[model samples]
Target: MSADYDLLIIGGGINGAGIARDAAGRGAKVLLVEKDDLASHTSSASTKLVHGGLRYLEHFEFRLVRESLIERERLLKIAPHIIWPLRFVLPHDKGLRPKWMLRLGLFLYDNLGGRKLLPPTRTVDLRQLPHAEILEDRLIKGFEYSDCWVEDARLVVLNAMDARERGAEIRTRTECTGLLRGDTHWTAMLHGEQGDARVTARIVINAAGPWVDGVLDNAIPGIKHQNLRLVKGSHLVFPKLYEGRHAYIFQNKDNRIVFAIPYEHDFTLVGTTDALFTGDPDKVEISSEEARYICDAINEYLSVDVTPEQAIWSYSGVRPLYEDNSGNNSTVTRDYVFELDDKDGAPPILSIFGGKITTYRKLAEHALEKIGGFEDRSWTADACLPGGDIDPARFDSFFAEKMAQYPWFDPEGVRRLLRAYGTRIDRIIGSAADAGDLGQHFGATLYEAELQYLVEEEFAASAEDVLWRRSKLGLHIDAEGQERVADWFSART
Candidate 1:
C-alpha cells in the first residue's frame, strides 16, 4: 500500500482519531492504526460527560476548565445527536464549601464559556423540588447546572468515520509493531487482517493513550520522553435505583465526588475511582476492593444504598496523564501536552500525553499545528462530523418523522437509533417493515442487522467491539445471547 502521507497516528482512541480527522480535513494525508477496534481502550470507557469538570475548580485548573467549557458548546453544535445537554444536581454539603462559595464557582463555570445553547446554573430548594425529594434529609439545598453527555465510543467512531470520509485510511485490529527511520521517511510495520505490511510516512504521531511509552520503547527504540503517567480509573453500572431524569453528584468524605446518572433506561452509571497505577494499561481491571470502594462512596451520600451484587457491569481504564508530580493523585493535571520530536529532520514524531474527550477537538488542532509547519487552513472548527448533519433544533421533529417512517420500531429503539447512529439509522434499518426484518434478535435491543452494519461500515471486528464498545447491550444480554454473537462473529471471520 502507498505510504506517502503527511501523518500517521498510533492508537485509534479519541486523541488519535480527532487528530486524524482534523489533519485530513486540512488536506493532510493521514493513516491511523489501532491495535484493537476503535475505542476498545479508554476512549469508550469514560464517565461520558462533556463538561468543565466542576471539581477542577478546587485545584484551580482554570485554563483546562475554561477550554473544556468552551469545547462543550463547540462539540454540541458539531454532534448534537450524540452530545446533548443534561442537568446535574449537586446536593449541598453544609460542611464542605459553604453555599456562597458553591454559588461563586457555579457563577464562574456558567460565564467561563461563551455560554450559548445551554441553560445556566441555578439554586434549588431541596425542600420543595422533585429532584430534592430523593436527596438525604441533611442536604437542604443544591445547585443545578448544565453539561453535555455523550455516547463516548460513538464519538470515537464518528471521528474515524469522518476521517475516512475526508480521504484518510483507518486500520483496525492493526498493531503498530515497529517504527524505523528510513532514508527519507519513517517506516511503520503494521500487522492486521492483511497480515504484516510496511508503510512509510513523513510524520508519526504517538497518540497511544496509556501505551504511549511502550510504543516508544519497543517500536522506536531509544526514543525518550519524560511526560506520560498512566493512572487507573474504574466505574460500575448498577440497576436503576432512582426515578428521575436528572443525574446526581455526591461529594465523598475524601473530597472526591461520585456520579449516579440514569443509564440504559433501566440502569445507573456510578464510578470513577482514581488510583496511581504502575502496571500495564492493557492488564488494568477493576479490583474487588476498588468496586466496593466505589459502592461504599455512593452509599455514603445517596438515599438508596447499593451493594456489589447490585452492579450489573463494571469497567476500568488507564488515563494517560502528563506527569506533573503533584502530591495528590486527585490534584494531577487533566490538561494535555504534546511532545514534538524532529531530530535532524528525520521525519517528525509527535507524542501526545494528556487529554479528555471534551477537549479532543482542540487538542487535535494543536497537535497538527506542531506536526507540520505548513498545511491547509484549519477546517474542523466548523466542519460537522459524519452523521452529525441533523439540525439540533429539529431533533424532536426529525425523530418523530423517523418513528412515523418505521412505525414498527419501538420508541426506545428509535431513540437509541437516533442517539447512536444519528441521521444514518435509515441506512442501518433500511426499509425493514417489522422487527423480524431487522434480522436475528440477540436479546435486549441488539439485532443482527445493527451488528452487521457496525462490522461492515464502522470497523467493528470482535464480539467485545460489538457488545462493549459499539453498544452497552452486554449489561442486558444473557450468556446465551453473548455466545450466539461470539459464534456468529467467529464464523463470519
Candidate 2:
C-alpha cells in the first residue's frame, strides 16, 4: 500500500515530540498528531525537575537512575536557557529515615551517574542559615544535591518546533479517531477543527503518554495488551513559602516525598500526591483530599503551616506507568517500555509506556531502534534544540550581550526573554526600536509581537497557550489582562 508519510506519531507530549524530531532528522517523512495543545497533560504537570529520581535508588532502579542522571547533564548543555542547574535541599527527618541512610543515598546518587558539570551532594547546617527560621527546628541539618529545572511545556514545544523545521508535519488539536492496518501501511482517520482526513503511514508510533492503551484498544481491538497503572499526581502553588533559590524535598510519615520549589519568581510550587486514578486523564483535577495531603506532607517539615485555602493554583495529571504490580503507587517504575506489533508483515505499531521528561530523548532513540528502518547511529546526543546554542559556561556573557543589544528593554524583561527564548529572542524582538514597537501590551512583559510569534511559529491556538504553556505569565497577569489577551486571539482568529 502507498503511504502518505513514513511515520505517523500519536500524542504531542514530550515523548511523541522527541520521537518526531528524531525520526524527521533521520530523514523519515513524519506526521505528528495531537488531540490537544502540546504538553497539556502529564508532561506539563510534572514537578518540573530533570533529576535522576534520587528515591529510585531505594527501589534499586540503578539503570534508570544512571541513564536519567546522564541525560540531565546532556539536557542542561543542549537547552541551557530553559534547562539550568537547581540545588535541592533534603531536610533530615529523624522519624522517617535516619541520617546514615540519607547520607548513603546521597553518596550513591552523587557517584552513580557520571558526575560532571553539576556539583556533588554536600551536607548543610540548616540551623546556621537565615532561612532556618522557616524550617522546623529539629531539621538542624540537611543535604544539598544537584538537579536541573526545566520549563517543562517549552521543552515539548521546542521539540515539536524542531521537528517541524526538519520537515515533519505537526498537527495540534488533531485527534486520531481510528486506525486500519494493511500489509504495508496503516490508514488513520484524523478529526480536528478543520474536519476529518485520512492519513496513510508506513509505521505508527503511539507515544501517547496516558492514552497508549486506549489508542491500541481502539486501533487493534481483541489484542491482549499490558495494563497501565494510571496514577494521579497533583501539585499546589502557594505564595513563596521560603526565601531561597534552592528547593526543598520534604519527607513525610508515609515515606513519600514532596518538593517545594521556587516558581515564577513570585511563588512556591509544591506538590505531588500519588493516588490510584480511575477517571479520565484529561478531566483529572487536584482533589481537596489530595490538596490537604500535600499541605499535610510539607507542613510536617516547614515552620509555616499551610492550609488548602492558601493555595493560589493547582494542577493534576495521570501518569501512564507500566503496571509493575507494586504495592504502593509511589513505587511504580518510571522507566519506559516499548511494545512492537508487526505480525504477518503488516505495518508496525510501536507503543510507548512509562517515561519521564529527563529520559525522553533516549526513549525516542530506543523507539526508532526498535522500529528498525532508521540508521543505526544516534544523532540527537550532540545536536542542540532550537535556541539552545548558548555556551553553558558563559551564559552570563550571552545575557549581557543580549541586554546590550536591546538597551531599550528592561533588564529584567530581557533576562526573562533570554530564559524563555534564548537565541530566538531576536526573532521575537526583531527590529523593535522600543517597547511600544513590540505592539499591544497584554500584561507583564507579554506583547502582541510575541503572541503573534507563538501563534505563527509555535502551535499556539489560543491565549492560554501563550499565558500558561509557552510562558507562565498566567501566574502574574490578572483577570482583565487575561480576558484582553483572549479577546485579541478571538478577534484575530
Candidate 3:
C-alpha cells in the first residue's frame, strides 16, 4: 500500500522538529505531530544553555562533551539571534573539589572540541572583582569560561517553521493515539483540536520524550522495552541576585553543580536538582524539598542568603535519560540513543531514547542516518535556522542597521524584537511608523503585530504560546496584561 507521508514523527520537542526540518530539506514527505505545543515540556524546561557539559568530564563522557562543544559553536553561528556567548563564573570552594581539579577540567574544556571563536577559560581573583562582593568572603578565586545561552522553546518553534517551509506538515496539540504497522506502511491515528484523523506513513519516528516507552507500547503492544530512566530536574527564578551579564556556577558538597544565571533582565534563574522520578510526567513539579535544596545550594556560595518564598516562578521537567544502569540519577547519560525496530518486511520504527538540547541537530543527522534511504547528505550543518541568517560576527552591525532603519521604535523594544526574530523582525514591524502603528500593546513590548505574526506564521494558537514559548514576555507582564492577551486569542479563535 502507498503511504501518505514518507516519515511520521510523533513528538514536537527539539528532536522531532529538528528531524522534520532535516528530513523535509532532504525532500521527504514528512508529518510531525505533537501531543502538546512545541517544547511544552522538557525542551522548554531546559537550563537554557548550549554548553559542553563541564561536569560530564567527571563521568568520563568525553565524546558527548566534545560533540556538544563543537555543536555549541555551530549553533551559535547558525542561530545568533537566540544563541550567544555567555561567560560562566565558577567559584573555587575550599570544601568542595580542589582548585587543581577544577583547573584541569577547565584546561581540558578549553582544548577539547577544537575551541575557537569563544574566549578560553581564565582564572580570576575574586578578591579584586565585584564577584567577590557577591560571593562569601571565604572564596577568593574563581574561573570564568564561555558557553552559549539559548531560548530553547524558540529553537523548537524555529525548527518547526523551517520544516514547514521545506514542505513538512507540523501539527501541534495533536496526539498519536495508536499505530497499526504493516509490511510496507503504518497507519497512525491522531487526535487534535480539529478531531480524530489517520495517516499512513512508511516510517514512524517516536520522539515522544518522556512518553517514549508509552508511545512504543501503544504502537506495538506488549513489546518488552526498558530504555528510559525518568529523572526530574527543577529550576527556580528569583529576583535579580547580582548585577552582571556573567552567570555563576556553584559547586555543592555532593559534587553536584547548580547555576545562577541572569534571566529576563530582572531575575536570576537558579536551577536544577536531579532526583529519581516515577509516575506521570505531566504531573511533575518542584517539591518543597527540591526548592529548599536549591536555595541551600546557592546560599552556600552567596553571601546574601535566599529563601524559597523569594522564588517568583519555578518549573520542573523530567528527562527521559537513556537507562544505562548507572547508580546515580545525575550520572545517567545525557547523550542520545536510537533503537530501530525492523523485522522481516515490517516497516521500521526508530525510537529516540535520550538527548539534550545542545546536540539536537546532530541527533537529527544521526537519526536520519539510522533510518537510511535518504539521498541528500547532511545539510543542517551549513544551513541556518529561521531568522538565523545574520552572521554571528556581524550581529552588532546588523543590530545597528536595524536601529537606524527603525529609529522610531524604542531602542530596547527593537533590541528585543531583533533578539527574538533576527532579520525576520521586519515581518513584525512592517510599515509601522511608530508604536501606535504596531497595533494593540499587550504590555511588555508585545504588540498585536507580533501576536498576529505568531498566529499566522509561527503556529502560535494561544496566549501562552506567544508569551512563554515564542518569547519570555510572560515574565515581565502582569496578570491583567496576560488576561488581555488571552482575551485577544479567545476572541480571534
Which number leads on lDDT? 3
Instruction: Find the 10 residues in a row with the least total lDDT in model 3.
Output: 125-134
| TM-score, cand. 3 | 0.99
Screening candidate 3 with a backbone cut-off below 3 angstroms (N, C-alpha, C), the clashing residue pairs are: none
Cα miss at 465, model 2 (Å)? 0.8
Q: Tell me the TM-score of each prediction against the true structure.
A: 0.96, 0.98, 0.99
CA lDDT of each prediction against the hidden true structure? 0.86, 0.92, 0.93
Candidates sorted by TM-score, best first? 3, 2, 1
Q: Candidate 2 residues 196-291, lDDT tens each? A: 999899999998888899899977999766669999999999998888799999988888899999998899999899999988897999998999
Winner of 1 and 2 under lDDT: 2
Clashing residue pairs in candidate 2 are: none
TM-score of 2: 0.98
lDDT of 1 by residue, 1-493 (tens): 4457778899999999999898888788889999988998889889999999888998898899999999998898889889888899888887777788888889999998879889999888877667544666777888999998998998999999999988999998899999987756788888997899988998889999988877777646765655677778898988887887888888888888888888888998998988888887778888888899998987766767778888878889999899999877777899998877687777778888989999999999888777655474877767777678888778999899998999888888888888888888988899898999989899887888998899888998878888888788787789999999998899986
Error of 3 at 157 (Å): 0.5
Task: List the candidate numbers ranked by lDDT, top first.
Answer: 3, 2, 1
Off by over 4 Å in 2: 224-226
Candidate 3 stretches with Cα past 4 Å from truth are none
